[model samples]
Target chain A: MSSAAQGLRRTGSARRQPARPAWRERPKPATQAAKAVALAAVVLLVTVPFLIIVSTSFASNAEVVANGGWVLWPQHPTLNAYRELFDGGIVTHALWVSAGVTVIGTAASLACTIGLAYALSRRDVFGGKPILLLILFTFLFPPGMIPGFLLIKGLHLLNSYGSLVAPVLVNVFNLVVLRGFFQSVPEELYEAARLDGAGEWLILRRIVLPLSKAALAVVGLFYAVSYWNAWFYASIYLDSDHWPLQQVLRTYVVGGSQLADSAAGDASAVAAPQTIQMAVLVVATVPILLVYPFLQKYFTKGVLTGAVKS
Target chain B: MAIAERDATGRTGAAGASGADRRAGRKGRGTRLTRLRRDWVLLALMAPGVAYFLVFHYGALAGNVIAFKDYVPFDGLWASQWVGLDNFQKMFGDPDFWSAVLNTVWIALLQLVFFFPVPIALAMLLHSLTRDSVRKFVQSVAYLPHFLSWVIVVAVFQQVLGETGLLNNVLGDAHLHTVDVIGNPGAFKPLVIAEVIWKDCGWGTIIFLAALTQVDEQQYEAAAIDGAGPWRRFWHITLPSVRPIIVLLLIMRLGDILSVGFEQMLLQRASVGPDAAEVIDTFVYYKGLVGGDYGYAAAAGLFKGVVGAALVFAANKVAHRLGEQGVYR
Candidate 1:
């Protein structure tokens, strides 16, 4: 009856239509070949730097420096950088901390976010409206940094790992996307669950979540990426010893530090500093590279549909 | 348009509220309360989320009180003496503060001018690709950088372009003079912008790509029938179809002018120095938390926050005036 409600109805229908344009037809074989070449060129441009980083990471220091600070393909590629990184040093400790934080943080964040989003998605759920408003209000007026830090401090979370996880447990954008997805599930499914004497939790676990896998994968990947990449909170809250890989990378690469402890090597080992730095870059970026392919299938449609409706 | 509908709904809800008010004094004055009492199980499930917001968000909001206080660690916030307007005065008079503001505006403007069109162009290019597999593969590669941390991105740039890095190494082999890009004060802004484009332009394509999907196939077919060339069809059909999304994103970007990537600048600040790298965010961090000048930093931060909010509000209002759908209803 309400226009906002009407718009919501229209949006759902619009999504279902898949509106193929009549004028647009499949391309000719020649055009398709041309398109493939252009696309490959774009992909090549994006991939080259990453390839350079990876290659240089494995390259010998002499080879790296001799080739004008590049090692397109290492003459004598070695696992020495990785060997040094994992051998009980600052980067080793940082690597462990980053892994722990990402795993623990992503799980906690995904759970809390899904719980809140699902509750809000249900129109019949009691206290949902006020709760939704409370959550949404935070989007409009985010807390200032000082207050956030102070609150973390007051909770005695400072210098602790919990500070990194607690402050950003639920991203509002992710919550909205997840909620939009849950809302799109057919109402008949919920009714059928109720008829079968299934409770909300059971329905959520068996029915809702199963159906929303694509969305969950996308949102989960988003959470994982953000958590892995995060350094600001860790920089402010944790001691330097407890710093994550990104923060460690920040100190070494951006701060331009050349002290070889173990990650790059001892000062006497003698390697190209740029190569060592590139090695660190690869180490930091590898997690994202690992998770991308699995989620790439759902990304475009999942992200676009979720974002546009909001 | 959405707001007009919302207003009508709210007006009707308001009318319904008076009827509920009249019934409230009768037999079921406490019915809603009774309903709430029955919903305790649901409340238990919702408690963590509610508590999370109460502490992290609202508690932090209450922490803004430190903006008026001296904020000594031992004394704590409640015990600190209020120093009204001193911080604001100091912030206004600081030359570094002014430079940070100017730098922020300049970078944001550059992003608006140069960086903004990248995603649109990228989406167009992707949209034009005839083969779906080729288009998707390109997209995956383009989106890769967005996943990297700022630390990694900066590191990548340094390795490729720093004085003794790959570019220099290669140039030396060819007997060419090295050109500095990374950490150079003159090149800092452009480098930062370039880094942003590399990392985010593809991600930005998400919205434009979505818009492109909405363009009617019939329109393109009609243009082809009219003997229009590919370029003419693109200009007539595709660009206009995606115009609204572009306008909407531009307005949103304008509102975020004060924030030109705090972490990225902070990481690079030592090399480029504050003169070139300082933005409002770094300025606030240095003034308040890092320098132990809480009140002044808060003032600077508060100023940025207010201005950002005002910009969003103004932009949204302008969008509404132009008969466009803004970010919110």
Candidate 2:
């Protein structure tokens, strides 16, 4: 989000068009106010609910119950819900599972995508055309859900972390984006690298990867986000003990399962189910929030580079 | 956030760079062996991704043959008994299947009517803002929800609109009639659409905003010079500029219309009952996975896949007729 703003600041001075050009007149005060109100409504529609979720997650149990399950402003904010969640129970176990999947899955996905994208971007590699065509064909007509589930079963991937990552190891969209970004590197650079005795792998590591940091970051973030957010396959393939955070949270929060056993002890140890649910929601949300600012700066540059150049 | 464009032909990506050189550089049959030997490293680099597609995509695709089989737990995919269209006959005659189809089509049409044009309008609104900071802030906030999982989004909505949720609480205080939304059958379609709007409308604007930026300032200036008002200027310049992309997206949406949010519906299906919320994807899940009717469910899924692929092919043909790039050439 801030990435676009940073792009604006970086290019604002060099921008050719003025805010109000000579041929255009400024709008009336009423119009400006209406526009402001509209923009504010858009922002509020997004933010207010999020603010309430975060606030209710920290509110004391009594206050949350009194507020009828959604606390706007927590007068007595407490960390008891989060405390109970992390008391070595299901939420804690699932959190580690999600983290483990995210780290391993993102790394594997990025590595495979980089290799394939780089190979496809180059000219006249043997079998590259056929391979690229075959992959792109699958994008048009994806494999069906039942067959996909059956495959996982046949492969004995049921209830394993491998089921989460192996089946979706390389996303075609990310591959195409990286491929487009790689192709944008001038051929002259490749020639110069070759003259200096650089092999393909070395060229990739030293030249292509360094130059394509923006795109790489964007793709990496995408892989990470998808892995973290994934639960559908987890629901189908994994047992409850092996489930990821999102899947477990789905049962407790959306499925409205009992919260007393979600943690280690009796009912008194946990906060209100409402607050515990909100806490789980916040835990599921925080990683994305933590990671967004760093890579979001590349959104415009990375996306446009692929789209325009390809 | 992806834009409207799809790279259907990888050849076009390389077309601009090494079109002639590739033909000349790696010529006839003699050097083909040499070229293969030389390019082994590149092929080695591609092995993991290539193997992934082979095993997961095509492997699963081949597994679709079960649609014609009576699947047994002990008997594998190839070993299953060939029932030969029996599953399809059963699926076609099922009233539940037709009802699911109806629900899918009705929900997709609602999305087309409500969820389609939001981003375009939001993009235009964001574009018209002269204050760069405000525009950036709004874009950032609006796009935040798209990152959330369906589980979380559904939970948030339930928290806001469930029987004991915040909306009812506020209404109770104000002594007004409270609207029941989350699990209500009549409100399901609108609730789903609203969830979609909250999550994706902001992210969808990125493509249109990119298109809006590409509109030459001179065109807007020229329209203003011609004494056109803001609305007329938008009609003449802005709308025309984004129309191509809008058409491209609509065609693409048509291709994907049947597949609604499966996990989303699955999460809330028990609360509202299948009559109100069952679509093809969730129906496949419940029938095949939960209910243990593998062959019949695979048939339903195969039917959906074939129709969806046909729609894409037809949509692409229409795109070519319109002289625009579709999902493929």
Candidate 3:
């Protein structure tokens, strides 16, 4: 046996083979403790704020005020904040806008990206090299803000929903990701499909896409998240009545604007501003939290493939 | 179509006068035609994306003409009077613009110094873990914040560190003095950098972790048998393995130094005022879009873009000099 294998076996005899290489002796206690501390710090740093946000959103107004604007954990959880949020006002409307934009934008972006990426992945496609360089050149030197804003204004998309989608229809990074995944599909499978007289669309649908579900899901999630979280375009292009949930969150929560005017006529005068703001933050964030785990499974594979191949 | 087809067939016919020429040229043109015809579906599929780039990117590029014009909204782009370098000259003379430039550079340098190495360090910590489940769970938790919008991230910070936030609450309960962090002009740069590190350090680790996984197992084993300890093995094996990626990411960071969080800064710009918060992008937004000084704003933006593009080229050249591929060929 090779010395490495023998060493591993010898280490195996002493205890378990180290989860990494046999070279790692069991980590010294200090190393173990340090790692544990680092892990705990990371987890707590990420989770504590979420915990506070959710808890404060569910806390009673009196409790929130008494606790100085945040609740680590609610004494009595309540949905009153959420009810007030959806009481047919700006937050509810913005939530619908966010959902609609995310759904439509993700679908359109994924379809366009997949179609373009599939086309570009083919070796015999006409003008592919120049087209790719053109796309990539934009990545290097993006069109500046004033010009972009002017283009949107010129196209009469300033107040339209198309302002958000049109300006960022297909991200080149996502395109490259999908293209890398498509190129990784075996040439033999493509040749086989072509030999069967399958058209490009059919090949993409029946062959390429099926093999690319992980990549598509990851890229789709990216599009969905960006569209969902987008506030800047909405802030600039649309009026207050057409803002998305993120923009609403930005205005009320981060912008520190009192919602008293927005909630002026609402029946739920009992809900505190902190509660409502936290509720809005949670509502804006929850959809991504829900979708993240599934797509996260593919993130490493998808991103690495895209990064390495590109 | 008719003219092209007739030309093609006529050429084939002319080539047909010579047997060998006819076979080669006719076959070549026929296959080329066939290939062209076969690729129509792909071309059609590419149309939306191609059109999107043309209209949004190239069309926007064309709109950069306003930088040279004394633009009036009533007169529109074409009717505006051309003023040559007047807008640029104005920008060069504006102290606010220079302050914004300085702030941008300051924030970017702080991020480079403080935030850049965090992921590499975190990746090392995660890579040393002996348990799979712990590592996976930590990775998932850490990467979660990366997907949160900057608004949410900033709000999270406010909830944790603002005057009436968790930190103050704890301090109040303990009868201690409270620290003002959120909206404090003096603390704005560090606060923004801290937020960036919190949001991205985990996501950044993804690439380094991937690099770590690629470090050869044999190297570690060989080093261990040779009496090297963990730190030595890590220094000799792990760091060297990920050096190329680290350099690549560093170059990319250098190229992007001018853009130090537009949305994040915009969201907080009002809180800290322009003195502490203004950057090139926000300056452009406020000047051009909000203030209606379109020509001047466009000029400032064009300057930033030109310098940024130049930086990218220079950084790429430096990378090539160091025997790295950098971003492109």
Candidate 4:
């Protein structure tokens, strides 16, 4: 009787608690304050360089030079660096190439990966186990640089846009993740479709694709980012004019080419290398920043579930 | 029990409906043909995928045999002269190659030690937060760096620490002596490690976060009721829950000790000089691709691959012995 009464008392006391308490049982205001401070510190450490660049990109040459190469906030922010970059046509052209590669590459990758992942997901599919082993074996022993490069060259793919798309169309890791996700779909769904007289294509298009949206999105994002950031292959397979924005950024930032010759600008503004580099950095990062928030939720679940494999 | 019986009935019914499928199995030779015939649609669906592997993956694997020969583009892979272990010997004798191997191992070890724990710590902090909104906000902010390119990452580091960059500028403003951080060999290792942590530490938290979610809330409640302190409860409950994940990640990381991030190292190699930054991947790129010493680079590549596979096999064996579920069967 006392135990029942105690249970009732505990339930009553729990109901009395507020919907959302400002603080929990520990009451570590000092600790939370310290954590908040520490988190802010970490964020600042990661973000300050970014801030400096964006601020410096707009700063006047005199201010930047006088400030000994950086301005925390532009004394007078200007779009002169951007104007020069756009006028040069190189940055504009490279931007288009990068966007094209990302779009085409992502589309091709998604289609092939989905097709493959879907086929492999079905346990009763002919030769599925061996095919999966074949794919997984590549992850274990990746084809070396010389061999991979030679294969591309042998196919007469050098200097062709197809080189970028064809060689890396389907990442095995992405494929495996997608396959795992596809496999997780209830067998009853496939059976239901089969009973409804749906063929493999109809079932894939109607049933599988809808269920695998999160996996597809995550895989698509990985492909797109990889294509955007890829410069090594472009360096090997592409001519100088055909290089992507990353390669262009690499040339400017790492190679230390002045933005002056590209445009006959006020040497002072162009002379501030800090802002110019930051402008490039911002350009490189803008695509990811724009797309990341929308796909944030998929990342938490989609990534790890896919990553459960070795 | 009823469901199992019903499933068996359904299976038998399905088998009865597909008479030819069952009948063909009675004739052993015909069963193979029937199985192939039945899966024709699946094969059609899988054609492009198989073609991809054959062309890109297996095709590339076949090309690795050139490591045994003196490869010439004009003469081609098959036509090249056979020079068996000479390439491997050259790679072994090369001091530069040895140093690259050393640098890769050292950097990987540092990352395993320093960068590995930060994500777990961050995840714990996020887990402990009372407000869900705050935790989500912190995670969103932390994950931003992971998506940024290594070029941008390197550029960010350079703009902040390069000669006439932000750090020196700040120091100058304060009337303090400037420090040369960027392009300094002494600081290069720390710079690479820091960049890696900034870029990937948050991404690493995803697995840990997933692992943490499976922990039962009732355990925490019981611990609290039992008057166990937060620290004690954390040690007893939370750590044990996530221990397998930690062990699994460590084993996987150990297997990949030779492959530090390729693009990151490649980008910074020129700045820091090859001594500090030349890892196995970059060394292969320079020697095989740029210098056209295909055999030597291929030999080195094969060597790394062999070691990696061996390590994975060993790690799996060890995990099984320890009574833990490993990466593979």
Among these predictions, the greatest TM-score belongs to 2
Interface RMSD of each: 7.1, 3.8, 11.1, 8.4
Worst 10 residues of 3 chain A by lDDT: A1-10
| Predicted candidate 3 versus true structure: per-residue lDDT over B1-329, tens digit per residue | 12212322343333234432322211343466686786789999999999999999999988999999999999999999999999999999999999999999999999999999999999888777766567777888998999999999999999999999999989999999999999899999999999999999999987677666655567788889999987898888988867877777877888888889999999999999999999999999999989999999999998988888888889888988988667665
Q: What tens digits encode model 1's per-residue C-alpha lDDT throughout A65-126?
A: 66767778787888776766666778878889999999999998888888887877765456
Model 4 chain B weakest lDDT span, ten residues long: B1-10
What order do you get sorting by lDDT, best first? 2, 3, 4, 1
Query: TM-scores of the models, in the given order?
Result: 0.88, 0.95, 0.92, 0.90
Q: For all candidates listed, what's the TM-score of chain B alone?
A: 0.88, 0.93, 0.90, 0.89
- After superposition of all CA atoms, the RMSD between model 1 and the true structure is 6.1
Q: Mind giving the per-residue lDDT tens digits that candidate 2 earns over A1-310?
A: 5556554333343554436667778789998898889889889888888899999999998988887888899998899888888888888899999999999999999999999999998767888888999998887778898899999999999999999999899998889888887877766677777778778888899999999888899899999999999999999899988989999889888998866563533454447878888989999999989887765577665354335322
User: Between the candidate structures 1 and 4, which one is better when assessed by lDDT?
Assistant: 4
User: Which digits, one per residue and each the tens of the lDDT, describe model 4 over residues A5-113?
Assistant: 2221232323323233322265577987988987887678777877888888777777878887777888788887666566656777788999999999999888888
The parts of candidate 4 lying over 4 Å away from their true place are A1-25, A263-273, B1-30
What are the runs in model 1 whose C-alpha is more than 4 Å off?
A1-41, A262-273, A308-310, B1-30
Write candidate 3's Cα lDDT for A1-310 as tens digits: 1221222122232443435554568767887788788889999999998999999999999999888898889998998889888878888888899999999999999989988999987654777889998999898888899899888888888888888888889998889877766766755566677677777789899998998887888889999999998999999899988899999899888989867645522855688889999999999999989998876776665243334423
Task: Output the number of the DockQ-best candidate.
Answer: 2
Please list all clashing residue pairs in model 2, or write none if there are none. Answer: none
